[model samples]
Every structure is written in structure tokens, then in C-alpha cells.
Target chain A: MDVKTRKITGQVIFVLLALYLDGLMKWAFLNNMNTGEVMLIPQLMLMVLVMLSMRISDRRQLITYGIVFGLIYDSYYFGMIGLYTVLLPLAMVGVDHYKFLFVKANMGYEISIYFLALTFMQSGIYILERLLQQTKVDTMDFITFTLGPTLLWNMIVFFILYIPLANLSDWLVKYRRDK
Target chain B: MQKFFSNKKLIILMLIIIVTFGLLAVSVNIKDKKSTPPVIQQVGNDTVSIVGGIFAYPTNAVKNASSEFSDLYNTYTENRRLKSKIGELAQNQAKLKVVQEENKKLKDELKLNATLTDYTFVNASVLSRSPSSWQSYLTINRGQTSGLKKNMPVMSGKGLIGRIIEVNKISSKVELISTDNELNDKFASEIQSDNKNVTGIVSKYDSDSGDLVMENVTSTKDVKKGQKVITSGLGGLTPRGLYIGKVSAIKKDNYGMTNSVYITPAAELRNFTVVTVIKSSVSGEE
Candidate 1:
């Protein structure tokens, strides 16, 4: 009911929207089922989470968002648990831990952070899936086809969406300090 | 020893790794071995799917509209070609209806309840496709509540696409045929050639060429390019006579010991929103 709760609710909604968009964007456009070997996985949810974690100083809240959304993501999309469930929270916590290094969040700092997080989350998933025998793609092919394209595409998307997303997350997190 | 163990960050990192592998291993085992996921996971998936429908509907609409616009581009040529077949198609349909009636009567006389070809279907709109590479699954709206079960062969408008891998309370995941997963994507298929039908397992997906590779073929001698391939219904949950694709090419394996038949899948594997899950009237061994 208070301004703080409402702001937190807005942040959650923002992340939720990103979560759903990740799947929808893939379904609607990035679905290259037949011809292409290069795959581009939209990580808008990770982007949003990274942006929010940069601004939202509360480590507990960041981890909570990570675990809850990660669970939902794993259960809903991947059908197996732990890929997103573990990596999402860990990536957020990693962001939160090193966030003090940057004095102010800007396009450059946020984009680089997202790049690192995306690489970590994706490589973590690749390793886990490979170990489980869920996928047989070798490390070279994975880096060349899946990781490279996904990073390039997501970075471009981050560039195009950086202004709106960064502003929105900034507003969502800054209101508590204003009060 | 106590100081090293007491380092809080180190302890947390170890805990994270342990939990990560633990959850991943257990869930992967459950996915492979269990018919259904745990009850809590089912409830969580169903709830998320219900909310996802709101977003999915609009996206599906846009997809359909765009595909339709593309269809419009080729409507003229398609219509001209299809017009020539209209008369033959009508005759075939009438003959098919009569034959179906006579076949039903014969089955009734023989006291046969259901055959491999006897199947009913439930239609469900696709909610979303997993963005992951290895587990390329599409979450559909219908699930156990809609008389759906695991391993049901799902079809898009044209032909066979994939099979249901996971079913929740009201949503299910269909593993696409294009997935490179070594397990859980095989379909028993047969190519209809001039002399005899050659049976094979539609196994691996060739991502480079975008063709499905059918391995362990009985004999590829009679197989030729452009012949229709259908589910032979020899084993597994799928019923017989479901159209899979056409025989694209037959090539010998690397060692040249056996042959593998490549098929051009009939389903577009894209642009379609709704999928039909076929429920065979005759149940197979569980």
C-alpha cells in the first residue's frame, strides 16, 4: 500500500513483462527451427534483472527476484529445473556484489555488465546441459553458433532498449530514496 | 581449518554449486523417468501457462496474420495449381468416405473396436517456444485436463511436428522434431515406395540441412526421393498412417555399412500457432 511497496511491485511487473517477452519474442520472430544453425536466445529478462539489480541496493530482494523468477522460468520454459533457477540468482548476486565498483549506472556500464551476465548464464546452462547429456553440441560449435549469435543479438537489443529500460528501472528504484 | 570453513563467501559459493548440480540432476532424472513432474511443479507450470495465454493469444494472432499475408503473395499460383486438382480431390474424397463407411461396417462385423489408424485429436494453441537450443519445446494450452498424455504425437496444420514430453494440469510441452537431443525424439516411420514400405526410425535431426535423418532402416533399396513417409506405428505410443514427410535422400553412413534416409519434414516447424495432439483409440503397452 505504501510508495515503497508500490515501487517494488512496479519492478516485479517490469521483470515479469521481460520474462514473458523472452519467450514471445522467440516464438514470434527468432524461431529459426528449420534452416539456421546459428541460434539467438533472447535474454530480455536477464537484461531487465541486471538493470534492476544495478539500481536496487537490497541484496535480499535481488536474490529473491532471481530465485522466484528463475524457478518460474525453468519450470515453464525449460521443463527442467536448476538451469535458470540457480544461474539467475547467482548472476544477480554477482552483479549486486560488484555493483559498488561503478559509481553511477550508465549505458556503457550496464551494457557491459549485461554482456558478462549473459555469457555466464548461457555458458553455465551449456555446461550443465552438456554434462546431463541433454545436448551434444561441442564447445567450439556452441561458442561459434549459439553463444556468438545470441550475444550479438542480445547486445543489439540492449542498445535499442537501453534508454527506456534503464530509465524505467532507475525510476522504479530511485523513488524510495526520494521519500 | 575453522577459519577457512568460516569464510562466508566461500561457504556460500560451495553451497551454490552443490545445490545447482543437485537440482539439475534430480530434475533431469525426474523428467526422463517420471510420467508427470511433481505436483507442485505441475501446479506452478499450469498457473504460469494460464497467465501466459493472455500474451500468447495476441502474438499468435500477429503470427497468423503475417503468415496469411505471405500466403496471399502466392495465392494466385497456388490457386491455379490447386484448381487442376480440385476435381480429382473431390472424387477421392467421395471414394474415401464410402470406403471409410464400408471399413467401419466390416470392423463392426468383426467386433474390432479400434485400430492403429483410429485416432481422435485435441486442438491446442501454442503458448510459447523455449528459447533454449537443446530442449526446443513448445508449451501448448491443453494438458491432462484435456485428455492429453505424454508421448502423444502432435501435428500442426500440415503434418507431424513432435510429441508431448511433459503434461501439467492445463498445459503441456511438445518436444519439436528438430531438436538434436539423442533421447526422446525418435518416431517409427515407414517410406511408401512403389514395391514395399521400408520401415525406419526417424531419429536425428540434421541442423545444417534442416532435414530429419531416419536411421536403422530395414532396407533402403526400394526407397527413392519424393516418396511419402508416414508413421508405421510399429512401436511406441503414436498411431499408424500419420504423415511425417517425404523421402528427401538416402545416404550411406560414414562407414558405409548401413543407409540413412533423410526426410524433408512436412510441417513448416514455424508460423503455426495451433497444434493438434492425436489420441489413439487403441492404447499401446505402457
Candidate 2:
């Protein structure tokens, strides 16, 4: 395989790793199971996707990744189509659109951008699920129990893992001339 | 007309909106209908779950080890408490075996192959739990090939935990009893009261208090705290006498209309790696 193809494969593997981690972390650590009212959903895949979108420059590529991963995520995890399948790509494109305004990516900018993206994606999911009558959780209860804790937990995770994750995504997206 | 269609961006945006609603509506309809999802979706889920098992097994191993460590801390006191019950348990086991054999003979004589009380179980390991808030699904390794079907009650070691919501070729999703979804959470349950039974529907889950609300109860007068609740088999797919929980508290709804009995489910709802899916002998109407 050529270097370009190899890099793309590596990027896909990285994203997939993060995707599995989302399920694993929820299964292992954040398992609520008859205990707490606060539901914290770990969005590790979104964190990885945001990092990749910030690095990869192609708009078409971003949308494609979004739709493909979104489909898998919906089919396997949610068991319902169109929630992540639509929202994930929209979030990726949103990040890609405004990301150029920054001269250079840093912890603060990336963190804030991720924060907005997470908020947007989560709220979009909540609204869609609510409208579809899949969930009856009221807005206040949703904001309090589900949204707030999830954001805080995922943001703290993003903050801690930002350096290693950012470097890895950079390595995956960077062009090598030797190939 | 040609000039009106010239805006490519607007057309794309319109298409996206149409597609989004279309997909959501169709999927939601499919879910409500209880039909198998499209072929591509089933294949995709099975493939994903097959790969997911590799990751889930190791994580579940670690989880089991850690929980065992915690169990070790309380073993001494637990052992002392369990020693007293051992004698009673042995007697009960003997009696149960005799009764089971007699019942089987009676059933054969009566030409009854299966009844509401009869069921078989399939064991499956936990693959992954959905990260969504309201869905509350746990993917398991067993699926259609295992004779599993949707709406089968699943249990951990302790008691009933949930029911199968979706099934693929090799993987299925279990929707927990604690799910906030109104349509899928209700269980036809009954409480063993003095000399009689108090039947009700275990409908709502109170997340804040971590109690299951059993409504439509016949009488709260006979009901008491600590009474055992189990499936009544009124709904047919679920077998009778599947342990649900113990009656924790009884309260009146708003305006003091109907009584709702709060139950503390026996299943820990966590910690267990393997789950048993109970397939009832008598198939009911879908």
C-alpha cells in the first residue's frame, strides 16, 4: 500500500478504537446500574472525531467519515437510525467550517470548539429522540440528569487526554513526502 | 424554473432535511412495529458486534475480577449469614426436586407439553451497553441462531433485569427495566400477599429513588412491605413466577387516585458478565 493509503487506514483505525472505547468506558466505568440519578455518557468517539476533523482538510472526507461512522454508531449502539447518522456529520462540518478562523489550534480553542460540538450533537440527539417519542424525559430533567453530567465528564476526559490524542491525530493526518 | 434550481447549496440543504426526517420516521416506525430491521442493518450490527466481542471480553474480565475483589471484603460476614440458610436451602432443594419430578409426571399424564410457568434459558455474555440515556440497551453475544426472540425476559444471577428489544443474526440488544421509555418498560407483575395475590403492572421506573413503580394494583390493603413480586404471566410471552423484585413502598399518585407500589428489583442491574434469556414455552400473540 502507498503511504497516503496507509495514513488513511491508520486514521480509520484510530477512530474505530475510540468508537469501541466509548462502549467499553460506558460498560466498565460509567455504568449507572441502580445507583445514581446522574447519567454520564462517555463520548470518546466524538472526542476523537473532533480531533480528526480539525486536522483533516477535505470537506468531502469529513462528511463521509461522519456519515459512515454515524451509521455504524446508530446501528450498533442506538439501534435507531438517523440520530447520530445525521448529527455527527453536521457537527463535523460545523467544526470544519469555523475551525479556519483560528491561526493555530491550541488546548483552549480546541477545547471550546469540542465543547460546542458536544453540546450541539447531544442536544440534537435529545430533540430528535424526544420528538420521535423514544424518550419521555422532560427538558429540565434532561438538562439536569443527562446533559450536564455527560458534558462535564467528557470534557474532563478530553482535557486530560488532549495532548496524546492531538499528537496521534496529527501524525495520522500529516502528509509524508517520501511516498 | 431552471434559474430557480440553480442554487446548489439550497438544494443540498433541502435534501439533507428531507432525508433526515425520512430516515428518523422510518426507523422509529420499524422499531414500533417489532419487525426485523432491514437486511443491511442486521448484517452491519452483527459484524460490528462480532468485532466488539473481542474488546468486550477483556473488559468484562477486568470488571469481574474487580467485583470479585470487592466481594472478598464482605465474605466473612456473608459466610456467617449464609451458614444459617444452608440447612434450610438443602431441605428446600430436596423438596423442590421431588415436586419438580411429580409435576413433570402430572404434566405428561395431562398431555401438557408446556404451560405459562415453563421456560428455557439461553446464556449470553455482555458485549456492550449503549451510551444513550433513554435507550438503556445492553448488547449480548447470543442472537437469532440461539433461538432468541424479541421481548424475551433476561436475567442476571439474581433476578429479572430486562427484555430483548432487538435481535440480529449473532447479537441482540436487551432493554433494561429501568429504561424510561413508556411503551416498552411495563411488566405484568403480582405481589404475593397473605393467602392471595395482588396483581399489578410494573410500569414506571423512578430514577431518582431507584425504585420500579407497579401500578394498577387490585388492593393495597393486603400488600405489605417486603412482599415478593413476580411476573403473573397474564401477558403470555413472559413465564409466570419470574421474580421481579420486593415491594419497597406504596404511595398514592397525584390527587390520591390510584396506588403505586414501589419495588426494589432483586437484580443488581450491574456487575454480572453473563445474562440468561428466558424463552417461554407457550408462545403468545405478537
Distance (Å) between predicted and true CA of B149, model 2? 0.6
**Can you list each candidate's DockQ?**
0.91, 0.81
TM-score, every prediction: 0.98, 0.98
Best by lDDT: 1
RMSD of each: 1.1, 1.2
Each model's total of backbone clashes: 0, 0
Give the DockQ (C-alpha) for candidate 2. 0.81
Off by over 4 Å in 1: A176-179
Q: Model 2, A1-179: lDDT tens per residue?
A: 88899998998899888888888888888889796779999998999999999999999999999999999999999988998999999999999999889999999999999999999988999998888888877999889998899999989999999999999999999987883
True contacts kept of each: 0.93, 0.76
Docking class of 2: high
| Predicted structure with the largest DockQ when compared to the true one | 1
* Superposition error at B128 for model 2 (Å): 0.6
